[model samples]
Target: LDNNKFVETRFGKQLKPSSKSTTYDDVAENYDGQYRFAPIQEAQVSRAMIKRYFETMYDRAISDVVIVGAGSAGLTCAYHLASTRPDLKITIIEANVAPGGGAWLGGQLMTPMVIRKPADRFLQEICVPYEDEGAYVVVKHAALFTSTLLSRVLAMPNVVMMNATAVEDLIIHEDHAGQQRVAGVVTNWTLVALNHDTQSCMDPNTITCPVVVSATGHDGPMGAFSAKRLVSAGLLKELGNMRGLDMNRSEPAIVNNTREVAPGLIMAGMELSEHDGKNRMGPTFGGMIGSGIKAAHEALRVLDS
Candidate 1:
C-alpha cells in the first residue's frame, strides 16, 4: 500500500518500501568479514515479510491454543507449552507493538525487575543473569530479561506470535451436552481497536482454539477482557476486580488462584488476581511466572483430556 492507504488501514503512517532498487545485486564482495551483507530489491523485502506472516497466520487460524496478551505470563506459558508439546500449535495475540507488558518497565519506570524466590527459576531456565537477593532476585535491566524471554519463546517452532493485534471478544461455544466453553477469540488490529469508537464498522477476524489462556493483566481497556467479559455477559459468576496493592498477600493469592476459571478459559498473570479479587502485587514478578507455569500445565491437561 502507498503511504496514505497504509496510514488509513494501519491507523498510523509508516514509511513505505521504495519500489525501485538502486542496487539490485551490488555488494562489497572484496570484504571477507563474517558480517558482510548483500543488497536486494525493496519489493523482495516486503514480499518476504508478507509471505512469512501470512503463512504463520493461516496455519494458526485454527490453532490448538490462543494466548491473549503477550505479557510475562502469556509468553512464559507459551514457552513451557511449546517446550513440552511440540506437536501442538500455539499462537500468542498481543495488542501492543512490543510484548512484555509491564515487565519492560519496573516499578515507577525503573529498569530492575524483582522476582521472588521460586519464580527466579524461569529466569534461570532462560539463562538470564540476575542479582540474588535473600528472598528476591533482581534482574538489573528489565528490558534484557523481557527481550530474552521473548526471543526464546519466539524461537519455538510451534509458537506463532501475532503482535499488535487485539482480542475484541471471546468465541464461546456450547457443546451438545449444553456445556459452555470458550472456543476461541475475535480479533482485530490494535489500531482498529484503539480507534473503534471513531472508525467505521470494521469486521474483526476469528481464531479457533480448544483452549484460551487469558494473561491480559489488571489494567487497560482490554486487560482482563476475557474473564471480566465472561461475567458481564452472564456466562460466568461475579469476578471481584483486583484489590489494593498488598505484595505479600497478593503474590501467593495470584499464584494459587491461577487456574481454569471456565471450561476452556484459563486466567493467568494479573488477570487471575482480578478474577479472584486478590491483592495486587505491584512490580514483583514471581507470581506472574508461577501463574504462567500453572496455566501452561492446565492447558496441556485440558488438551490431553
Candidate 2:
C-alpha cells in the first residue's frame, strides 16, 4: 500500500481497495506513468502536487494504512499485517469499478476461480486460456510465488476494501514528536466512491493512521512519480541521475524473467526474480508485496517509536 500498488480481491483477481469505479490491473497499466499525456499546451506534466496535476482524480485522507492498487500484494500485506496486528486500521484505495478486477465481462462470474483455484497457478506461471464460445483469448501474467497465499489474508475481518478510488498525491510532512524526531504521512487520493446512505467513514474522508502502507506496484499511481522525484532529487545515487523510465527505474512491464530495482524510497521488486518457484521472480507482484509489507511494518515501527 505504501501509497501505490494493488490489493487482492476474492475473485482470484485484484481489487482496488478504495476503488469500485476502476480495476486493479487496469489501474496498474493505466497509471503506468507512460499512459501518455494530452499535450495540454506543450506537454506540461506539472511537477506540482498531484492534486494540481490531473483532472477526474480524487483523494481520501488516507493515513495509517492506505493501500494503493488493491492487488494480491496489497491484499496479502493487509491480510498478513492485520492478522499480525488486528488493531491497525487498514484502507484500500482501488481504481477499478468492481472487485475481482478481471473475472468476467458481463457480471456472470467464472468457474476457474471457484473451480481449479487459479491463483496458485498465477503465482507459479503465466496462464493463458481460450473459450470455445468466442474468438478472444485471456492471459494472466506472473507474479511472486507467495502471491497465492494471498487468500488467507483476504478473509480476515480487519481488512476493509474500497473500489474506484485512485491516488492523486501524497502529503509527506515532517512533524516533530516531543523534539525527539520528525515524521509524517498523509496521502491524498482521486475520486473516492463508497456505498450511499447514512454511514460512517464510508464517504470521502480524511483518516489519520500512525503508519501508511502503500501496495501500489512499480508503475503505481504515485510510486512512479515518487521514484522519478527521488531520482530528480538525486536520492537514488546507486542507479544514477535520472527520472521516469530511466534505466534505474523498474516498472513491472520491464520484468524480463527475474530482475529487480534497488531499494530506495521505493523498494525495488524485480530484484527477487531469481527466486525459484516464483512466476517470473521479478519485482512487480513479489516486490510490491514484500516492499509494501516492509513499509507497513516499518511504518508501524516508526509509529511505535
Candidate 3:
C-alpha cells in the first residue's frame, strides 16, 4: 500500500469498540484496556505488525523507524521489518538492561510475585523446573528466535541496534515550501554500566529522519508524543469529555502537535488507558501487535503515495 493511497488524516476511521456500556466497575467504566488469558498471542500480533511498518517506512524514504522500548513492541517491530525488508534501515533504543519489557514485568504473566490460581500453576510450569514448555519456550523462543533474526538482520547493511539510550527531544524540518517536512530525534544515554547502582551517560546526540515513528513504549519526556494527545486533551475541553491517554498525568501522551515539531509522527501500539478507552484485549500484546500492524499498514500507505 502506498502512502498516497491513505489520507493524512483518517477522519471517521477511528476504532469502534465492541462494547460501549460504562459499567460501574472502574475496570470497565472509567476506561482502560486490560484482560486475562493472553500473552504469547500479543507477541505474535506485534511481530506481524512491525513487519508491515518496515516496508512502509522503507519505501517512504524515511531513514529510521526508531523504537525506544525495544522490549516487546520495539523488538517485535524491528524483527518484523528486518525479516520482511532487510534493505530498510531500522534501529531499536532500549533503556533497560535487556530486551523484552513485559517479559520481565513480574506478575502472573507479567509480575510473578503476586501469584493467582492457574496463574501460579502457569508460572510454576514456565519457571525454574520448566515443566510447561509454553512459558519457557515462549521466552526461550523469543530469545533464540529474536537473536537469530536479529543476527541476520544486523548483518544486513541497513540495520542499527542501539541499547540503553534515552531519547529526550525531537528535531522537525519542513520541506516542499513548508507543506511537508522531516524529523530528527535527540537522545542522551549511558553505554557503560560502571556499577549496578551508579553509571554515567554520554552526551546527548541527535538522529534525524524524514518520517519518525515514536515507539518509546511509555509516553516519552513531555512533548514528543503524537497527534492523538492534543486532540484527546484539546477537544475534550469543549465537549467536556477528556477521554484519551495520560490517565493520571496532567498531560496525555498522544496529542496533536505540528509536524515541524513532530514531523509525520504517527503513533501505534499505544494503550487504551493512555486515552479514555478500554477493551478485554486492551493494553495486552494483542492490542499493540494489532496497532503496530495497523500503524505499519498506514505507514506503507503513506510511503506508497
Residue 12 Cα positional deviation in candidate 2, in Å, after optimal superposition:
19
Residue 17 deviation, candidate 1, in Å?
31
lDDT of 1 by residue, 1-305 (tens): 54453322111233455577645233333554333667799999999999999988888989999999988889888888888888999999999988999889778989899999989888888889999998999999889888988887887768889989999999998899988899999999999988888967988999999999999999577788887888976877888888999999998888788888988999899988778888998999898889898999999989989
Query: Which candidate should be chosen as best, given lDDT against the real structure?
Result: 1
Instruction: Judging by TM-score against the true structure, name the best candidate.
Output: 1
The residue-level lDDT of candidate 1 at 134 comes to 89
Q: What is the lDDT of residue 200 in candidate 3?
A: 54
Worst 10-residue lDDT window for candidate 2 reads: 257-266
- Cα shift from native, residue 276, model 3 (Å): 7.3
Candidate 3 overall lDDT versus native: 0.42
Which residue ranges in model 1 land beyond 4 Å of their true spot?
Answer: 1-37
In candidate 2, what are the lDDT values of residues 169-269, reduced to their tens digit? Answer: 34344435522111222233344332333445533434444444444433433333333433444434432222333222332322222221221122223
Model 1 residue 57 CA deviation in Å: 1.3
Evaluate residue 140 in candidate 1 and report its C-alpha lDDT on the 0 to 100 scale.
94
* TM-scores of all candidate predictions against the true structure: 0.87, 0.42, 0.48
